[model samples]
Target: MSLLSVLRAELAFGMTPLLDMASISVLEGERIGFIGRNGSGKSSLLAAMAGRLALDGGEVRRRDGLRVVLVEQEPALPLAASLRASLAARGGLRAADLEGDDWRSTARLQEFLQRFDLDGAIDPQQCSGGERKRAALALAFASQADILLLDEPTNHLDLDGIETLENLLIDEQRGQRAAIIITHDRRFLDRVATRIIELDRGALQSYPGNFAAYESRKALAMQSEALERRRFDRFWTQEEAWIRKGVEARRTRNEGRVRRLERLRAQREQRRERLGSVSMGVAPGERSGRMVAELEGVSKSFGVRAIVRDLSLRLMRGDRLALIGPNGAGKSTLLKLILGQIAPDAGTVRGGTRREIAFFDQQREALDPDKTLIETISPGSDWIEIGSSRKHVIAYLGEFLFPPRRTEAPVRTLSGGERNRLLLARLFARPANLLVLDEPTNDLDMETLELLEATLADYEGTLLLVSHDRRFLDNLATQCLVAEGNGLWKEYVGGYSDWLRQRAPPPRAEPTAAAEQDGEDGAGRQARPLAQRAAKLGFNERRELESLPGLIASLEQELAAMQERMARADYHRQGPEQIRSDRARSQQIEVLLEEKLRRWVELDARRPA
Candidate 1:
């Protein structure tokens, strides 16, 4: 059953078309992942669907009295109200009303707040970005709306928060509720989406499945579309050649052929071409010393709170490292210490020789809102040097999807994603042997994210990245430095998923003598001896546990071999079926490895102390 439908939507900004005859429907029990390039009006489409934005032409039809909620990318709350009061207002209830007879409503609201780990009495204005996002989500979920329009809900969320949201959204699949989400988190989409809707060149295209399935299907579609386009162009070219023949031939040309040629010209004129991808490159400066940066027993703190306690690590040349932690985990402080911008409180930090550094700030503080794009890229001259070649500033901005008209516009006019792209444009314009990026993937579109990932993968410089994007970290990081609570940080080999596999669970507390004698713990569960726990497993389970290590090793070898094959340039150019098959197999291996690792952990927990 359809909850809402958009009919031939047409919208435009000035001379640019934002939604050109675009249409879509929201059906019950469907979670749609809305995607597109940056500045392609994805947010606007959400607004229109939520009845917050009026279309210039066409209409939106909603089921009678259907409740729809729109969660903005950067949600704004009433400054003077408490978080609980804000939710009350959003749900069309007064705070006083909630305090009275509506026990169910109040309980529901509190439940969501608790689930999101938010304080209900806190002022909305005092909340952090992640907290604010959680507040908005809590409001959305508590509203019990028929359809939810969520824009970048994962923007400021940490890995744990993202996982929580993924589970909640997946649970929504069992109900009649529906959602249309606009996000750049690929893993989130793969986990939560029942279908994918793409907004490309002012048109909406739907793909039936999750992100991985969308990738495979879109690849094949693009290939077929390319072939069809070539055939059309070939015929158009022959018609053009015939029409341009001598005047005598034109006078004698068949009337029917002339009409067909005119129709062809019209058809060609009305066609919209696909937007080009971003062309990005880095200029790696002169090689630095083999040791990039090293910290000896580094410890940092503010007053009584320890940020990084006795953390020691060495960064070598060509090392691609990632910092994973919750917000306010002192990632910025760690970066500053490594860069020698700030001294550690109790340890020695050393920087390598001849190291030129470039940084991408997550807050985009380095960008001046008043400056034009051209001025930002090339300050004093019309041309700038990129590695040995000098290129016009306007041309360089164009490569980043900034039109010539927009080059002279101030940075404040650009959207969030556009601002990030501009920052990337500025960052890569310079040469550096060390790159430190903090949350660089926050507002980037998927295409730009993939391009940046590829560019960084090919970079010769040592990289230090702090991002919450799981897929991005998996693709690029060679090592992960994870924050284990209470200022302790640990380093693991490989990326985000690697850290998950290698990390051990917190040790269980030993039972007291009294509890041992009683054969029960304080929680009233059985407190078995180590031998008894080991013997509890069935024969099949024991066999599986013993075989897990071998299975894990075999899968890792296969995954590594597949990765090596994919590293070759020719692997990507293979047929769509082969490419899709390889991608599916790779994902399967990763999933299997993670499952086995989890089982191994479970089984290993029962071993003798």
Candidate 2:
């Protein structure tokens, strides 16, 4: 039942080994989730399996007549072709060629197009990032291949799109097809993967279940290792004591014991080397005032597409905030606005006098492809000065899994995940009061993402994060900011899922009075839903809508002024009583503002067609 088998694979980037002595087999009906830290050769192995990349060592054996297709992050399509035409081209089934053969081909093409919300008439070139990703997925799902290899399939998918894709790729009736996916979406992996293949340190380990099961098994293995280590140490201690007893006048008869002692010492060192831990904890820098940053009446537009408008917000000490939106929805623009990198069309942005900000730009624009990894951190030096401590460049790079021997290699040769790790190392090395991260989770593996969450949790500085990783947000963010790109921003208290529930479309607005009278009895119509009762504001909704802009502006000004006052050195030194009172007042204003904003979105959704 085996579909493919990778036997004793060995791969290295230059002299830096990637996959070493790794072997894995792909069996029939297996949905394998390929996972590991960044730059662990997951992509390389996938390419090797598809015969796209030549393997440096080890042969890949496939079942005869196996049809394997690898779908990458970007859809490789004819730019000028219409969406429908592209699908036809990928499926190899022309409209005319499909005469009466299989109508299911046309039916499936239409279903996938609709699921992705793609307009068939539009050129693929004109689609947005998410749209292109969806189109690629739709094509992959429509292919005739028996084995599908997907890379970061959820990169640009929205929540609904993700679920729809989950249904398609991880169905209960998987038929004869099998798949392998590379993704950081924990939920997606758990829902789709029948097995987990982890590639790390040039080694491969296969777990027979999903991510959760893998964690459980790994924990148990660690527990067993701990016990074994203790036993080995105890036994080695006795042998060491005997060996240290001078070996009976250095006699040749003691050579066997001496060799046994050396072997035990080597074994201990090997274990320690395999279990080494890396610390990414931040160094305490200059503490900022209570108020970090504030924006008032902020608006930005690109060629009449209003990305943000009339937005106001305050950032206080220790604020871990996340910005959520679809691709191209101005999340990055908002980050720039906070940092004052670009002037908003109209707004006032204030940054604290002591604010020291560190930005992790998702675009990876800071990296120079021509520069070596070591040179990126220190121009010509072998160490970096972080606050009062000097960290060695080699050691620092090691923390991010960059081998010192590869220090001379250019940055362009690194994988997507490795680039992200390099960025993190460079950014976190500088002590800062605020950290602004844009899509930091894009190419990271689940392990790296969890480590990032841990680092952020331990960080004392304020955080502004823009990401689509739901797990990361729920763990690290204290508040959520939803940006809808049409000049709309909403703040929710909990994580992404909480925000989803808070915004779940209210049940179909009660039918019109005429429909209620004609379709139901008077008594049934009278028993209206409580949730609907508040939304049935004949003119109040409109009036509230009219006054919201001004009211929100007023509330923002009041809160910003108060927070700025409280940020003063003397004001913060005035003890906790005054601080509590000001926070209470600000919280009240925030609640009132959120309620009004929720009403605004509801009224907008209820607007007449």
Candidate 3:
């Protein structure tokens, strides 16, 4: 039996149709992985199923008396209270509210908190964002609802927390529970989901199996769409050519043919809307000296608490370094010290010769919330100067996907992903060599994140970044600086995955000798569980990885064309926006090409040669 069902659902945001004539069903024991681009209505559709939002049309039905729990992306937990107190207040687990056999509920709640790395003794007010989120997750699980709806549950979780969450959701009990998860972490979805559903073009589409299976299927669908569009395009071209010949050619009796051409035009526009090209116009900043920033015995403390202590590191041009650690691990503090916003207590922080830095702070320190999109970019000037050439403000805003109608909208009105894009746009405008970004992926959707990855891929300067998105870090970082909270720092070659392997504890010491001799059963019991925890991938990923090299070469060829164009003497004569836009595209392609190349090599190396 289905846990919930939606039939002929229709939803609209202003004039924008989100879901139209869409039907979806949640079945018992089914773990659905929901995916779509941002604003594709994944969250809204979930809300509809949970009866939190009213649908414009159609019906939603849930099993009578069924309990549903929703864990929001931005957890709405009480602040100003202890984390334990907040959790204990739920599920009738409180000491005062507890009845017979209710102590188990309280114990279960405690276990959840511990698993998420949230100590029950800590105050929610004092906890960092990630800790607060952990507490929220604990609360959601403790509810013991019949169905669970989680939105981006992995966002702020550390690597260990992410793995633990995966284990909990994939275990027998939780695995059979009816639930839907919306996550951009492909790895997480692959591990936890039994099936995949994508919300695309105002419809719900399902694909059996996991993320890899969905990707394989989605690729085939895209190929089909491309072919169909090509066929239509050929037909449309012939009709348009005939129609344009003369007024007599478009006879009154054949008026239907002209209307058909108009319908074809609309269909083409719809297809373009569904699958858009990526254009990241992040200008490659000026080149700096070989060394960009250096930290020598840097120490920082806030009264009794130490954040960074005797930490030493150097940033070199062309270095793509990712800073990773726990919530309060001083990644942001380190970025500040390098930028000279704050001084290190016991060490020297210096920049390389001619180093100009651009910072994309998670808080968006450079943006003026009161300013409109246009004002933020060009201020009062009607034009923005890109390398001494002036480009119209509206045109400049367009490069970052801001439509002309929305150019005057206040920055505060933009969504988090849009704001991040704005931050990147502003950051790229500066001719800087050192780019330091702190938690830039905080609320960005997958598409924006992918675009940012491409832009930074071609970045010719030094990059120091802190992000929780594993995919983002894996795609860009040349090295990783791991901040082991409390001032300990470790540098690992490659990305977060490499660091995880480097940090993994060694295996247990052969059953402690004496215990092994006690009995064969004792040895067997000890060894049984240790042998249970190990794994690998399947066909879709292997196939995708194998195809990356060819894709990479194609991108490189296109990148070379952009580069060749930029090298022409008259390139600058093209409007400054065009010149800069081409350069940004060149950089984006370069980054994407390298990403594919690396992925192909990694996947290839895992096998015979």
Candidate 3 accuracy as lDDT: 0.75
Record all residue pairs in model 1 with backbone atoms less than 3 Å apart, i.e. clashing: none
Instruction: List model 2 lDDT by residue over 245-317, tens digit each.
Output: 7668357887777888899998886552242344576656799999988989988899989988988988899
Q: Is candidate 1 or candidate 3 better by lDDT?
A: 1
Which ranges of candidate 1 are over 4 A from the true structure? 246-253, 506-558, 568-609
lDDT score, candidate 3, position 363: 68
Give all candidates' CA lDDT scores.
Answer: 0.87, 0.78, 0.75
lDDT of 3 by residue, 1-609 (tens): 787889999999987789989998888888889988777788898888778899999999888888887777776556435677766654334545433345777677777888787787777667766776778778777776778888888877877788878877777335446879988876676667889999887888999877656765666676677688789989989988978877564678888888988898887766534745335655555678898888989899988888888888887889989988776777787778877789988999987888777788776767888999888887788887665556787877777777789999998898766787788777777677788888777666656666788778777788888877776787689999887767878778887666765785655655556765665564555563333322233577678877787787789789778778876877668964455356445544644564576667556645433
- Over 4 Å off, model 3: 79-81, 88-95, 98-102, 121-127, 172-175, 236-272, 275-278, 387-389, 504-609
What tens-digit string does per-residue lDDT give for candidate 1 at 1-609? Answer: 999999999999887788999999899999999999887889998998888899999899999999999999998887546888877876678778777645887888788899888989998778988998998898888777999899999999888788878878887557899999999998788778899999998899999988878887887788788899999999999988987874343455476788888999999998889888889999768898999999989999998889999989999999999999988889998899889999888989989999999999999999999999998999989998999888999999999999899999999999998999999999999999999999999889988998898799889999999998898899889999999978899999999988986899667667667766665445324565444545567778889889999999999999999999998978878975677667767765776676688788777776546
Clashes of each: 0, 1, 0
C-alpha lDDT (0 to 100) for residue 224 of candidate 2: 75
